[model samples]
Target: MGIRLCIGSVNPSKVRGVVSAFQSYFPVSDVRAVKVETGLPPQPIGLDVIVRGAELRARLAMSGDCDFSTGVEAGFYRFGSTYFDVEAAYVVSRELGESLGFSPSFPVPPWFVDEILSGRFRELEEIVDSLYKTENIGEKTGFISLLTRHVVVRSELSRLATLMALTKILNRELYEKGALR
Candidate 1:
């Protein structure tokens, strides 16, 4: 058996993205997934906030019986007049470097702010669900869902990028320790 990995999320799309990203560095046998709660306010507004959120999930994932655990948290922050969303990823393992934090933020469409702050979306997932019509956020967006079709959602990609960054950090740690022969 290889390193048992766990992700602190039940979202399959997220799991697929993160698993794919890490697979490039480690074999599938070494990775795994698990679900954990992330206590974060809606549209987290800064790196520190989101990092804390990621850490919370990571710690929860690591608490389980696994070799390693990963936590990914995504949220939006405002810079000047523009708003950007970022994903923060955390990897935890007893054998690995205690902890590492990285944030990957990208600018999103402006109109999203109004729709987001309208009290209709309490979390990033809610926004995505509303947009995709896959998971409704209380049916608050009657015709708005149609408009979402025109809007592009980059949140998932940003989250995946954060996961990739974390994987890079972990791989480097493994290589330095001769764990990645």
Candidate 2:
């Protein structure tokens, strides 16, 4: 029997990222994409909340049939006076337990953060879409693509986060030995 993987979201960028990341380390045979609620605000703030959202998604996506489940969430984290956008990935498996990873964060524009804080916009995508005149940018190239001129797309962020999360699973012995504890 081959490995079966389930991703918590059906978003194209997230699904692509998780699938690509998993395929890099495992010979995945079956992949399923399901829509799961994060039970978080549209734009979650803080690293803890973002990780929690990912954990929730991962746990909710788990089923009896799949060998593994993953959740990917993107949000903002504040550092000093600046807010940076970061993506978090959480993976869960019966054998490996669970692990969390994050992608490199990039500072978001202060004005954008202000808008989010003002309750004028609940999600960064809303502001970006309105400014860029694009629709559902999150499902496509993503705001990161726009900021980086397509050098770093959303899927890449998700993929990197997932890879980082899988590190613990890949080196299970090291982790078990308290290398990361």
Q: Candidate 1: lDDT of 114?
A: 71
**Please, what is the whole-model Cα lDDT of each candidate in the order they appear?**
0.61, 0.93
TM-score, candidate 2, is 0.96
Question: TM-score for all predictions?
Answer: 0.69, 0.96
Over all chains combined, what TM-score does candidate 1 have?
Answer: 0.69
| Candidate 1 wrongly placed segments (more than 4 Å) | 30-32, 98-104, 125-164, 167-181
Query: Ten residues in a row with the worst lDDT in model 1?
Result: 136-145
Q: Give Cα distance to truth, residue 101, candidate 1, Å.
A: 5.5
* Model 2 poorest 10 in a row by lDDT: 172-181
